[model samples]
Target chain A: MSIILNHVNYIYGEDGPLAVKALDDVCLQIPDGQFVGIIGHTGSGKSTLVQHMNGLLRAASGHIYFNGEDIYDKDFQMKKLRSKVGLVFQYPEHQLFEIDVFSDVCFGPKNLGLDRREAELRAFDALRKVGMPAELYYQSPFELSGGQKRRAAIAGVLAMSPEVLILDEPTAGLDPKGRDEILRQIKELQVRTNMTILLVSHSMEDVAEYVDRIIVMNKGKVMYDDVPREVFSHYKELEKIGLAAPQVTYILHALKDRGFDVDVNATTTGEAVETVLGALGRKGTYI
Target chain B: MLRDITLGQYYQTESVIHRLDPRVKLGGTLLYIISLFLFRNFLGYGAAAVFLAAVIGLSHVPFKFIVKGMKAIVFLLLITVVFNLFLTPGTELVSVWKLTITVEGLRTAVTMAVRLTMLIIGSSLMTLTTTPNNLTDGMERMMRPLKVFKVPVHEVAMIMSIALRFIPILLEETDKIMKAQIARGADFETGNIVKRAKALVPLLVPLFISAFRRANDLAMAMEARCYRGGEGRTKMKPLVYEKRDRLGYLCIFVYLAVGITVGRLRF
Candidate 1:
C-alpha cells in the first residue's frame, strides 16, 4: 500500500573487478503500518535492499515505488520522498559531529529548509520522543554512551517526521542492557508515532520479539516472507540458513520432538510455561 | 569512488628482501638509486645492470607489478621523452609538423626515458616489496643523524607512518559518503561540469566532517591507550644490518660506476 519494490537488483562495483550482485530481482511490498523485520546473515544484501527504500540505492534496473509512485521516476521529488522514508544507518552514531545533541538532531530538519524556531522545536520534540532530557540537549553526543549516541542519531532522523522509519542493525554490538533499552524504545516509538517500521537485523531473537512480519534473506535472495510466527515455524529452514528462531520457540520444537506436547505458539518462555500447565490440566496428566 | 585507490601496493612474498631489516632495505634502496644514475662507462653500466638484476631477482617481486606502477606516470614519462627528443635540438634526422627529430635528440630521449622509467620502477619495486611502517622506520633510523641538526627526524617519520595508516581509511570513508550522496539522487556522473562540481559539495562536506570525527576519535583513543610522542618509544623489532647488507652496498657501488659510464656513452 505504500512502498513496492518490483524486480529490484543491486550490484556493487558495477564496472570494477570487485563487482558483486548484492541483491537479485528482490520484490517486496511494505504496506503501511507493517512492522517488518528483515533477517539475513552478514553480507546477505540486507543493507543494500533497505537503502533502495528511500532512493538511497537506485536499482541498477528496477522500480521502487513510494506512496504508489515510482520513487526513481524522472519527475519524482526525491528530496521529499527521502524525508518521508528515513533511513537510520548502522553505527549512525559515528555520523555525529555537531558540538551538542540539539544541533545534531536538528540537522535533518534544518537541511529540509525549516526556519530556526521550527527546526529547534522539531529537534526538541524528537529528542523527547527518544527519551533524551532537555538538560542533555547542550551536552556533546561524544560524551554519551554507545546507546545514547545511537538514540541521538535516531532522533536526528525522527526530527524529519518520516512516516516510514528504517533501521539497519540498530542494536548490534551493544551490551545486553543497551540492546534491551534500544529495542524497547523502538517499540514505544512505533506505537506512539504510528509509524511503519522496517528493521533490518541479524539477530533472530529481536525479530521474533518485535516484528509483526519477518523476511528472511540468504545470499542475495529472499528465502521466506511471512508473519514472524509462520516464518520461524520453519525451524529447520532457519537453521539451514545459519539462523534460529527465538530460544523459546526452538525449545518448544525440541520438546515436541522429544515426545512432549509443547504448544509451539508459545513463542515466549512465560507463554510456554503457562500453556504447558493449561494443557496438563486439560489432558488430566496432573493431579 | 575512493575505493579504487590501490594503497600500500606491497607485493606479498616470503622473500629474504621482505624479511630483511627495513633499515637495511631502505639503505640498500638509496644505494641502488645512487648506482642507477652514476654510470659513465659501458662496463660500469653493465655491472650496475647485473647488480640491479640480481637484487630484483632476489627480491622475487614480479616485474609486471613494477611495470604496472610505472603506468600511473605514463604521461610524465612521455613528457620527459618528448621534451628531450624535440626540445633538445642537435644533428637533424627527420623533421615533421614543425618538430625536428635529430640523431642526438633520439639518443638523449631514449636515455632520459630509460633512466626515468628505471628510477620509477626501481623505487616502486622497493615500495612493493616493503611495508609502509618499515619504510618509515628505516627513514627514522637513517635520519637519526639529522637529529643533531634539530630536523625533527622522529616527527617526520611518525607523520609519514600515521599518514600511510590513514590513507586507506580516508579513501574508504570518502567512498561511503559518495555512495550515501548518490542514494539521495545526487548525480555524480552524466552532468555538465558546473552541476558535477556543485554535486561534489554534499560529498565533500560529509567527507571532511567524517574525517575530522575519525581523527578526533583516533587521537582520543591514542591518549586512552597512553601513546606518547616518540619519547621513550622503542622498536618491537630492532633492525640489524647483517653481512648481506654489506654485500648489497658493495654490489650497488659497482653499479653506480657503471651508470655514470652509460650516461657518457654515445651509442
Candidate 2:
C-alpha cells in the first residue's frame, strides 16, 4: 500500500540540444496514510517526479510500484491506478471545462464507470469534503471565485475516491485566508479519510505546519528527505539551492545567534513561540 | 503521446543553410516546391532527391527527425498510392478479381509519392532552419509591396509569428489537460472515432478558453507597452541580404533549371 520509485530516471527531449535530465535515479518510498510535502526550486523535477507516481509519465529507466506491484507490468490497469492515485495539476481551476461544477466533479467518477446517481453522489460528497458550498455546485465553474474554483477542481479529483491524492501547488496565487482554508481542508481530508497526501508546494510554512515529512529536491536529485524539523535544520544548505525553510525557522535561528537558548529547529510560528517561552522561563529571565 | 508532435519545432544548428537569410530560404523553398511540380519523370525526381538530400545534409539536422515528420502524412501518402495504383486509366499490368494494376499507374503513383515527400521535406526544412521570428520578418519584408494596396501585411505577419510561437505552448497545455482528464479515468484510446472526439471535448473547451485568455493577456500587454500597428517600427536586427543568401539563391535557381531540363528530356 505504498508508492515506491526504484532508481527512476527520466529525461525530456532525449539526445536533443534542449535535452534535460528532469529526474535522475530518484528512489523514494511514499508510505500510505502519511502527509508528505515535496519542495524544490522551480525546474528541480518536483512536478516530473509526481507525474511518474501514477503512470502519467513513464520513467526512462527503472520502475514505479504501486502497492507492491509494478505499474508498468503488462497486466496492470493504468486507468485504475490513476483513479487510485489522483493528480491535481497546478492551477487546477483552469482544468474546469464542464458547464457546471457538479457535472465537472462527476467527470472523474463517471470515468471510473460509475452510474450517474453514484457519480453525482460521489461528486457531492467530494465537494462537501473540500468545503465547497452546496448551493454553488450547479453554478458554472467559471462563475466561481479563484478560491472557489480551486476547491471545485479539487472536488473533481476527490470524486474518484483516490487513496492517494497529489496536489501540485494547490494554494498557489491564493490569498492568505483562502490558502489557510484550502490547507486546513486538505489536512482534515487526510485525517478523515486516512488517505496518503503528497502536497507539492513552495510554501514552507504551510507544509511545515501540516505535513509529517518533507522531501527537498535540487538539480533533479533529493538533497534531503526527513521530518520538517530536521529538514529545516539544514536551512543553510537549502539556501544554496535557492530554497529556504519556513520564516519561523529563520527567526528561531536568528534568536539563537543572539544568545537566546532557543531550539532553532522550530519550523512553525506556534512551535517557535513555545520554544522561545520555554527558553526564557528556563533561564528565569524577564522579557 | 501528444509531446511526440514536432510541428513548428525548431532545430538549432550552425550551418550554411541555417546562416542564410530567411527571405532567401523562403524563396528557395518556394522554388524547390515549384521545381517538384515541374519534374514529370524519374530523371527530374532524381535531381530533386539529390537537391533535397544535399540541402538536408548541409542543414546538419538529423535525417531521422525529418523522416519522423513523414510519419504524419503516411495516411495521405497511402491514399494517393492506392488511388493511383487502381484508378488511373492505363495499360493493365496485373489483373486481380476487382483490382487492375497498370504500368503507367505504378509510375505515376511513385512519382506523385516522391513529389509529395519532397514538398513536405522542403517546407519542413524552411521551418526547421528558420526561427519563427525570422520567418515572420522575411514574410513581412516580401509582403511589404502589398502594403501599397492597403494590405495589413505587418499585422498578418505578427499574427502568424504569434501563432507559431504558441504551437509548442498549446501542445504543452493540451498535454496537461489530457493528463488531468486521464487521471480522472478518461479513456482516450479505447473508444471509437466519435467517442474519442467526444473525449476531446473536455480537452478542447478548456484549451480554447485558455487560448483566448492568453490572447487577451497578450493584447493587454502589447497595449500597455504602446504597441500600435507595425507603423514606423524599426527592426533591431534588420534583414540584410548577405553573400550566403545570394549563393543560396543561385543554388535554388540551378536546382530548378536542372529539374526543368530533366523534365524536357525524352527517354
Candidate 3:
C-alpha cells in the first residue's frame, strides 16, 4: 500500500544543448497514511519528483513501485492508478471548467465510471469536507472567491476517493488566513481518511507544522529525509540551499547561541514556546 | 507535447546574415520568391538553387535544419508533382495502360517540385535569421507608406508581434490545462469523433477562460506601463542599413537578374 521510488533519474530537454538533469538518483518511500512534505527552492526537482508518483512522468532510469507492483509494467493500468493516486497541481483553480461547482467536483468520480447518483453523492460529500457551503454548489466556480475556487478544486480531487493525495504547493498565492485554513483542512482530511499525503512545498514553516516527515531536495538530489525535529536540526545546511527551518526553530537557535539553555531543534511555534518556558523554569524565573 | 512546434522560431548564430538589416532580409526573401516563379527552364532553376545554396552557406544555418521545414509541405509537393506528371500534354515519354507520361509532364513535375522547395526554404531563411521583434520592426518600417492611407500600420505590426510572442506562452498553458484535465479523469484519447469533440469542451473552456484572463492582464499591464498604441514609440535598437545590408541587397538583385536572364536564354 506504499509507493517506493528506486534510484529515479529524470532529464529535461534530453540530449539537447539546453539539456538539464532535473532529477538525479532520488530514492524515497511513502508508506500508506504517512504525511510527507518535500521542500526545495525553485528548479530543485521537487515537482519532477512528485510527477513520477502517478505515472504522469517516466523516469530516465530506475523504477517506481506502487504497492509492490511496477507501475510501468506492460499490463499495469495507468488510468486506474491515476484514480487511486490523485494529483492536485499548483493553481488547481485554473482546471475548473464545469458550469457549476458541484459538476466540476463530480467530474473526477464520473470519470471513474461511478453511477451518476453515486458521483453526485461523492461530490457533495467532498464539497462538505472542504467546508464549501451548500448554497454555492450551483454557482459557477469562476464566480467564487479565490479561496473558494481553490477549495472546490481540491474537492474535485477528493471526490475520486484516492488512497494517496499529492498536492504541489496547495496554499501558494494565498493570504495568511487562507493559507492556514487550507492547511488545516488538509490536515483534517488526512486524519479522518488516513490517506497517504505528500505535500510539496517551499515554505518550511508550513511543512514543519503539519507533516510527520520532511524531505529536503537540492539541485536534483535529496539533501535530507527525516522527522521534522531531526531535519530542522541542520538549519545551517538547509540555509545553504536557500531553505530554512520554521522561523520558531531559528528563534530558538538564536537564544541557544546567546547562551540560553534551550533546545534549538524545536520546529513549530508551540514547541519553541515550551522549550523556552522549560529553560526559564530551570532558571526559576517562572513557575 | 505541443512544444515540438518551431514555427516563427529564430536560430541564434554569430554570422553576417543574422546581423544584416531585417528589412534587407524581408525584401530579399520576397524578391527571391518572385524569381522562383520566374524560372521557366533548367538554367533558371540552377541559378536560383546556387544562389539559395550560397545564401544558406553564408547564413550559417544548418542545412538539415532548413531542410526540416520541407517535411511540413511534403503532401502539397507530392500532389503538385502527381498532377503535373499526369496531366501536362507533350510528346509521350512512356505509354502505359490508359496513362501517358509526357516529356512535358515530366519536365513540369520536376520544375514544380523545385519551385515549391525553393519557395519554402527562401521564406524560412528569413525567419530563421531574424527574430520576431526585429521582423515586426522591419515590417512596420516597410509598411510606413500605408500610414498615409490611415492603415494603422504600426498597430497592426504591434498586434502581429504580440501574437507571435504569445504563441509559446499559450502553448505551454495548453499543455498545463490538458494535464490538469487528464488528472481529473477527462479522457482526451480513445474516444469517437463526437466523444472526442465533447471531451475538448473541458480543455477548451478552461483554455479560453485563461486566455481571456491573460489578455486582460496584458491590457492592464500595458496601461500601467503607458503602452499607448504605437505612438511616440522609439526603437531601442533602431533599424539601420549597414554596408553589409547594401551588399545583401546587391547580391539579391544580381541573383534575380541572373535568374531572369538564364530563364530567357535559349540553352
**All candidates in order of TM-score, best leading:** 2, 3, 1
Error of 3 at A265 (Å): 0.9
TM-score of 1: 0.70
Which of 1 and 3 is ahead in lDDT?
A: 3
**Tens digits of per-residue lDDT for model 2 on B169-223?**
8888888988888887887788789999898888898899899999999999999
Q: Model 1 residue B75 lDDT?
A: 90
Worst 10 residues of 2 chain B by lDDT: B1-10
lDDT of 1 by residue, A1-287 (tens): 59998999988866443579999999999999888999999899999899888876678988888888888778998788878888887765345657788987877787677999998999999999988767788998778888888888788888889989998898988898888788888888898777999999998888677778899998889999998778878878888888888888877777778867768866656678887777677678975
Off by over 4 Å in 3: A15-17, B57-70, B89-101
Candidate 2 off by > 4 Å: none
Per-model RMSD to reference: 6.1, 1.7, 2.3
Q: Give the CA lDDT, 0 to 100, for residue A200 in model 2.
A: 96
Error of 2 at B228 (Å): 2.0
lDDT over C-alpha atoms for residue A217 of model 2: 83
Identify the runs in model 1 with alpha carbons over 4 angstroms from their true place: A1-27, A52-81, A173-177, A191-194, A219-221, A236-242, A257-259, A268-274, A283-287, B11-122, B133-163, B173-260
- Which of the two candidates, 1 or 2, achieves a greater lDDT against the reference? 2
Ranking by DockQ: 2, 3, 1
Tell the DockQ for candidate 2.
Answer: 0.70
lDDT of 3 by residue, A71-174 (tens): 98999988988898888889765589999999999999999999999999999999999999889999999999878888998899889999999898888888
